[model samples]
Target: MKNVTIYTGPLCNFCDAAKRLLARNNVEYKEINIATVDGAMDEMITKANGKRTIPQIFFDDNHIGGYDDVRALEKENKLLELLK
Candidate 1:
């Protein structure tokens, strides 16, 4: 399986949804809640190409973006492929 990392924030519905999607797929992920960690947002922005949104998901080196993006991958039947 690939390394799954997600930058999230508290109270973000999309973040919850993104995490649920991964969990539903049995994908192990590292969740970085920016709201609880200082400078995490900055790190997320730098890593995500300045995207300030919550649930910035990454699989290995591939940036999978937000909730919709991850769902798109699932819809296209590519999400599990990435997990492998």
Candidate 2:
């Protein structure tokens, strides 16, 4: 499986939902909490191409976007392919 990363923040329902989706798919991920981690917010913004949002997801170094984006990919049955 490819490495997964998620840039998230506290009290974010979207982040929780995104995590749940990953869990359901049996995908392990590294969670970076911007609210508590120093410089995480700036890092997430840079990696997310200026999209300052919680649950910014990535597969390896490829940006997979936010929760809605990943959910859409799942719906299209493309997420697993990307993981591989």
Candidate 3:
């Protein structure tokens, strides 16, 4: 199984949407709330290669961008392959 990590902030609609999408696909993920954790934003930026955005997702260390990227993967029928 792929190890999925989501860097998020509280009250972020995109984050919530991303979580829901993952849940619907039965993909388990770790959620890191950057808003409440010090240094979390920096970590996310580093992982994302300087994309300062909420809902930075990593699948087994593979950067997956944000919610839109996730949805695009799903739309293209590539999400399940990555999840595996």
Tens-place lDDT per residue, model 2, 19-73, is 9999999999999999999999999899989999788999999998999999999
lDDT per residue as tens, model 1, 1-84: 899999998899999999999899999999999989889999889989989999899988778799999999999998898788
Give all candidates' CA lDDT scores: 0.91, 0.95, 0.95
lDDT of 2: 0.95
For all the candidates, what are their Cα RMSDs to the real structure?
0.8, 0.6, 0.7
Q: Candidates' TM-scores?
A: 0.95, 0.97, 0.96
**Residue pairs that clash (backbone atoms under 3 angstroms), model 2:** none
Worst-scoring 10-residue span by lDDT in model 3 = 75-84
- lDDT score, candidate 3: 0.95
On a 0 to 1 TM-score scale, where does candidate 3 land against the true structure?
0.96
Better candidate by TM-score, 1 or 3: 3
Candidates sorted by lDDT, best first: 3, 2, 1
Predicted structure 1, TM vs. truth: 0.95
